[model samples]
Target: MSAFEFVFTFYSLMLGLAAANVGTGFADMWRDRRAIQVGVCAPLLAAIVLVATMNLWLRFWRSWEGVEVGPWALITLVAYALPLVFLSRAMFPGAGSTTSLEDHFFQHRRVMLAALAATPGFSLIWYAAQGTLMPDWPNAWLAIRFFAPLALMALTGRTANRLGLALILVWMLVGLFR
Candidate 1:
């Protein structure tokens, strides 16, 4: 196998597991809908995680396909993938519990947001290590556009978190067209 393929095989599996985790979480909520209060926040978070995992998979192919894979690349890739898995797992309560999805979301919000916010920085570092070319923007507005609202949401109330998530979804949608 080519070097990228060799490394990507493992990465693909991780992403698949992340996606599956999100799907299963959603399914569990559906199956228990009669007993469970399926709330907005957790489902929204699941959507973000699922879409982000798919984006990461596409990014791996687009950015890393021709790049040389080494020990550090493997290490960084693992670091990147684990938080995604954690975020996926956090999207729902454990196998059996009576907590509502909203309660589960608030209970895990800090860790969930932390994991969500971390990936962009890790992506930057991974690309830097690989000498991948990044876009040069005017005044670093792009970075601020993401990190600022997330930081606000992480430190503020529920309203801010909802707003931040809306912003993130908008950004993701905008990114798709770019």
Candidate 2:
């Protein structure tokens, strides 16, 4: 593969790793097995997803060359990241403990489903906004990415769920506007 392709693949994998980090919240959730599991897994999951995102960008980084400021990838990426921010907030339980886990979970379920549901729309926007040469790829990949959150929404509850929802909302919003 070309250098760009290599970098992209590596980053994509890293993104997957970071996405994997979300799983840690699950491990943390369990009362008995929570500590070890979450402690080990959460960071790992985040790492995976983070890596994946960066790699994905690397793969497409060239697309930025001579490109305008506002592309679908940029919008989608920002939108996607927003949910993670909120989810991190919901999960961490900092100043805003009032946002219950249950609420988060319910919201997560809705958002994830919405994101999956919204795929076509997001794809359309991505195509129109970005003037994409490879429109089909990103849209398809997004559907693939939806799996983790979908399962998490179904199985998880409490804080994890809420975080999941928040993340999904970000996903949805990004798709909608992009």
- Which one is best on TM-score? 1
lDDT of 1: 0.74
- The TM-scores of all predictions, comma-separated, are 0.84, 0.40
Please, what are the lDDT tens digits per residue for candidate 1 over residues 21-99? 9999988989999998997777778887777777677767886646577887788778878888988987788878999
Candidate 2, run of 10 with poorest lDDT: 32-41
Off by over 4 Å in 2: 1-41, 70-77, 95-125, 128-139, 156-178
- Expressed as tens digits, the lDDT of each residue in 114-136 for candidate 2 is 43334334544566686762637
**Candidate 1 Cα errors over 4 Å, as ranges:** 127-149, 152-156
Score each candidate by Cα lDDT. 0.74, 0.44
Clashes of each: 0, 30
